[model samples]
Structure formats: C-alpha cells, structure tokens
Target: MEAILRIYTHYFIYYDIEMTQYANEIKISADNPKIGHVHKPNSEATLMGVNVNINSDGLRDKEYPVERGQKYRIIFLGDSITFGWGVEKEDTFETLLEVKLNEIKPTEVLNFGTGNYNSEQEVNLFFKKGQKYKPAHIVLFYFINDAEITPQKSKWEFLSHSRVITFFWSRIQGLMANLSESKSFKSYYSGLYSDDQQGWINTKKALTQMAQYSRANQIRFDVILLPELHNLNDYPLKAEHAKIITFLNENNINGIDLVPFFSSVEDPQELWVAADDAHPNKKAHQMIADFSFDFITRGIKWEKN
Candidate 1:
C-alpha cells in the first residue's frame, strides 16, 4: 500500500507542477496592449527541471543597462523559443551568441522574447521597450506559428492548477477547432499565409515596420526563420518558408532560414524539451548558436572602433 501510494503521488506531482509554475510566473499585462501579456518581474519558475528567472525588467536574461555603453548590442525578438523555453539561460542561443560575438568585439545580445507572441506583438514590444537599449543590430527569430493571431489570455485560469484537467480541456478545444474548421495541422498552418488572412497581413506589416526602422536608424537587422520541430529531415513547410523569404527580399530585409541546419538529425524528437513539449532542447540550442555565430561573423561588416 505504501509503494502504491508513492507511485500515485509521483504521478500527480509530475503532471501538475509545470502548469502551476507557468500560472504563477506569467501575468496579463494591461500596459502591454499589443502583446497582451508579460512575465512577472523578478519572479522565478521551474518547469521540466529547468529554471526560468525573470529580471527586474521582466526579461528572462540578466539585467542590462538601458543605455548602450560602447558595446555593440544586438536585440533578439521572437516568441518562446527565443525566450529559451525549457532550456537553461546559459545554454540558450542568445547567450551563446553573445559570448561568441564578444570574442571578436564587445557585444551584448538582449533577448526580448515572450511566450505566445505573434509577429505583431514582438514588433510592438520592440518599439515600446526594446529600442531604449539602442542596439546596433536586431535579430527576429521567426517561428512558423508567429503568423497566427495573438492568442488571448486563457479564460480557464482555475483549470491551470491541474495539468490533467488542462490536458483534457486542450484536447477538447483542439477537437472543437478541427470540427469547426475541418482542417489538419498542416492545412491550418498553410491557411494562415493565405492572401486574405489578417494574421499574415499584420505579420508583413510588422516586418515592414521593423525593416524600415532598422534601415532608417542604421541598425543591422536580420530575421532567422525557425522550423517546426516535429519533422526536420523532410520539412513540409517549405512553401511557407518561400513565402516569408520572398516578402523579406521584397522589403529589403535580411532573412536566414534555419530549417536546413537541423535537417541532418535522424530523429527530431531527440532535440525536443520533453516527450510532450516540442520546444528545443540544449543540443538544438547549441546547434543554433554555432550556426548563428558563423553567420554573424561572416556577414556582418565589423565597424572599427
């Protein structure tokens, strides 16, 4: 009876912990009208054996000076993946890249990633807060789902306490969404890029805004396209990639597609945060950092001090 009880306790704890932590750490930001939410300032959360600490400025990284002081600062904007998700802060690509770039010259990479952010929200956040850092460069990690509309804060706050309940609820919601739209995941993602889709339209508008701002301000800007992790060997989202690249080219924005980087992985699942979470693991982050390091060093024309 004791052994059986311990097994049950472990099972319950494993399922419920992450949900509770996420709820405690994230808050709806009334000030963030465009992004809709932000991390709780100076708070900490542990999810899937990883610690996420938000600074006083409500950013995931260490506190940085508001003023750029002779250091070449690079600002990274995106959703959760860029936020490091389930990965450690030191192992994240942003941190790794910062270290690598600083080897060549004084550099700082500011991570402005927020979970569940669409393209519009990311750009909005940058204009609202990120520009204060006066970064020399900007890198937007564009995930495939970033074209989707900004997700509203969940109304079922009470259910967040129980991962079991949240799991079933999400499953039911997906079922309803499928029933309503009758579209598979691939079809749904493809539909987001359709000419009439407001999400895609707004994404383009936001990208254009960022690109123009970068050009006008003499700030180097690049968009690194992040691939969907389910299947990397034969990525099925090539069409979406082409569409984004074409738009970037037309707008004179530098774009880097990262899909090919992970294609060599025989089993993409090995790079996942967990069996359930599709966010990249440490290995994947290292791969991104290595590739980004090479790209930045090769492409960026270093300004002599």
Candidate 2:
C-alpha cells in the first residue's frame, strides 16, 4: 500500500514532456489562401502549457525547396510567436519574412516554431529534430518573461499556458498555512520554481551557444527582442536595454530591439497579438518582418529603406 501510494504521489503525479509527444507542423493547407496554410486556427484546447497557445508551423518530414543558388539557410527558432501565435500559419512572420528576405538577401527561410517551447528546448530542437535543413541564420525571438521569471514546474513538465497549479503555488508560497503546514511537499513545490530559473539560465547559455553554433555550422545569428504585454516605458529602458545590448554585443551578435517600435503604440488590441495568447497577430508579424528587413539593411525607416 505504501509503495503504491509513493508511486502515485511521485512519478505518476508529474512527468516532463518528450520531443516525440509534440505535434509538429505537418502540412501547409492552401484552403485559406489569403491566410496561407494554417493547419489549425482557433484551437481553444491546450495541452499542458502549449495547447492553450494555438500555433502552427506548417512543416512536414519532407525537405522543402530553396531558391536556386541560395548560399544561406535562415531558420527562425523560438516559441509560438515564431510559430505565429494567434495568427494563421500562413500569416506567420517567418513566412512574411521569407517573402521579404528574398528581396534582400540570397538566403532561404525556414519557420520552425512551436508552442510551449522555451529557449533551451528550441536550441535542443534545432540540433536534433531540425538538423535536416542545416540552418545558416537562427533568429531567436524574445519575450520579457524570458529574463525575469522562470517556467513553473507545470511549464517544465507540461508545456502549456493554462496551468493554474503554478498560480496557486505562487499565491500559496507566502501563506504560512500552505508552506509551513506541509513542509515536505512545500519544499518540493518551492524547488519546482527553479525550473524557470534554469530556463532563464539556459536562455543565456543558448545565446552563447548560438554564436558558437553559427560559427560551427556556418550560420549568422540575430536575436529579435520581443516583448510581453508590458510596456517598456514603465521599465528601465536605458539600463535594461543596455544590459541586453551589452550581452549580445560581447558575443559579437546583433540584436533588433522591437520594444521601442512595439511600445510606441497605445492600443494593445491593435498589436493583434492573440488576446490571451503569447504570439502577435498577422499585422504585428508583418510589422516585425518589416522591422527585421530594415535592421538587416541597417536602416531606420521601413518606408524609406
């Protein structure tokens, strides 16, 4: 009875997700021609931390074609934002960028984004699952939460956004009755928060690895600093931005600060990022693509450039 109880309370109660369990981008459906090949839109159901965040990459096992004589393979690696979070797969920024980049550089673009995937998971994915394409440029998208907080145990173990467990954990942590009343389990719950810490650390490590990986694999790298719903003005823009820029600069890597451009607007609704989702909408993706093009060209004005 004790053994069964232990098993039930331990391993059976929680488990980390594996790469195999993920639903990869399968096909690009043209039915929604204007929107492109969005496999699944309006997916309300979430699995763990991922399902609630509906995104589709429109990928398959088969290799796709690149433009003739293209020397570089540019791969967009990140979470649902790269996967076009709330937008249809066709309207994803990567796809938009593909249309735009072709007009700029002699490179091919591949969109390899997914839901609930952190920076470490993304880097790991490129080496293992996405090796076939042999990427030359990896664009690491950013969210403010990437640096400040860690993924909860639910996020680490599950990979979805709608976890009430972590919320409860955060709320209950300060409560004497919760943590003190159940010392053993409370300690265990507290330890779970480290996963987010580890995730943030992994992000830095991944950034460094990106520079090395680019050289080792002959790829150029850029970090696109995205934002959460928060406004940058409320935060220490100069100091914090300096820290980030310094980090990337030390690595001799370029970073495009999307915060200034994104934060200029007043309407969070206008941003078109999914209302409850982590990714931006079609318009926002296009704006990002345009901004990326301008950054690559070393120009400020998208229209003038």
Candidate 3:
C-alpha cells in the first residue's frame, strides 16, 4: 500500500499535472495582426492551477498611469517565463524586484511579458504599447527560445478536449520531428542561430532596433538571459549563451546571464514548477528578484560608444 501511494504521488506530480493537461482551457491570448498576439486585456484565467490576471493594458501587472510621475519606471519584456507562468503575480521576479527597489526610492517595474513571444514580437509590442508607460529603464528577460519564430496556435480542435491525447500527440510529434531531422535537443537549439534562419535574423534586427531606440531616448536598457531550467549542473547551452552575449556586445547592449546564480543549486528540479514542467517556481523567482535587486540598485553604467 505504501509503494502504491508512492507511485500515485509520482505519477500525479510528474505526468498527470503537466502543462499539456491544462493548455486547452487557458483563453487569455488575443490575436494581434501587427505584432502577432497579445494577452486579452482584463482577462483572468486559471493556468496550470495558478491564477493569471491581465490588466486593462493587457499586461500581467496592475494598471498604472501613462506618466512616470517622479517614479523610476522600469519595463520588462519577455515570454511566458517572464510572464510568471505557473507562478503568482506577487511571487514573480518583476513584482519582487519592484518591492525591493521601492525600498530605496519610488519605483515601478512594469511587466510586459506574454507567452510564445519572440524577440521581434516583444520589441514590436514595446513600441506599440509599452512606450506609453514612459519607462526610465527597460529590461528584456530573454529566454533561449526567444530567437525562434513566433508559434501559431495549433488548429487541431480535438486535441484541446482530451489531455491524455494532447500529451501523447505532443510526445509523438516531438519524437518524429527529432527523428526526421536527425537532431538531438542540443543540436536543434544550436541550429536556431543558423545564418539562413529568418527568425534569428529578425531577432538580431529587433534587438538592434530596441538598443538604438533606448540609446536615442536615453533609457537604460539591458538583457537578462534566463537559462533553460531543465539542467543546471552540466549546462549544455553555454555555446548558445555565448553566441547571444557576443551579439549583444556588438550591438552595445548589456547582457546579464543568470545561469550562474541558478547553476549553483544542487538540484535544479527543486526550482521548477512541477516535475514535468520546467518553468521556475516561486523559490526560483525569489532568487532572481534578490540577484536582480542588487544589480539594478548598483546603477551600473552601460556605455554605448
């Protein structure tokens, strides 16, 4: 009986509670022709058993005025991780960092994160909506997959109804794709930066545009490269990280890699939302907030010459 209980616990945590199980019911995304998509304004839903609320501005934070109003306004851009997927809004690094920074002075860190957002979409979103916030600083929480092309929602309606089928179908498709390309996960990730990949090309252009705009406007801008939390002890994506950092340096943008802070953990899975879902949990978000608080408060000068 004890052994059966253990097995059931394992299955529930590692398999039954996966993101694929709840992907169907989350209806926060709204189609936007200009920048691909954005979260539906004033939307609220339960995603992966966590409450997700979108403000009137379509951001994942509380609504704020367009004017800075003597507050040091900071805007963060990224995908789901930055959106605090599987985590609460208060537990998100952005919220934590905002609280920490406000201790020093008046500050507001606005979260402009969305799921499935690539660099192009993020930058475009900033120009379209985020600029009106009059942020004094901008931070892009860049994940490894940000260079990939924007993904369209799957049109398979049936898959949405059955979690079991959705899970199996995803696994099967992934296996087939890997087999057909003769590519492992490492190779597949590294291949995203190939010279011919339009996604990577567009990513570079988008980042460059952001850096240039930030400089011209005198807004301090930086990129915090969020690591893939799958494995931290022996990270296999160092090469990809270096490639991104080099690009940032060439474009005169500061890239802060957060891998070392996370890699120090003995077991990376402890920081995950679930055994199967690698999105950072509340603990990981706290660590990020602590580290970022120091960095942001230091007022490091990023010279663009």
The candidate scoring highest on lDDT is: 1
Question: What pairs collide in candidate 3?
Answer: none
What is the C-alpha lDDT profile of model 2 across 140-221, one tens digit per residue? Answer: 7765444423233322543322224433444475475554755543233334234345644666786788688787877667
lDDT measured at residue 263 in model 1 versus the true structure, 0 to 100: 91
Give TM per candidate: 0.88, 0.60, 0.85
Arrange candidates by TM-score, descending.
Answer: 1, 3, 2
Backbone collisions counted per model = 0, 13, 0
Per-candidate Cα lDDT values, in order, are 0.82, 0.54, 0.79
Ranking by lDDT: 1, 3, 2
Stretch of 10 with least lDDT, candidate 3: 14-23
Give candidate 1 misplaced runs (Cα > 4 Å): 1-20, 154-164, 173-183, 303-305
Candidate 3 wrongly placed segments (more than 4 Å): 1-34, 153-165, 174-183, 300-305
* TM-score, candidate number 2: 0.60
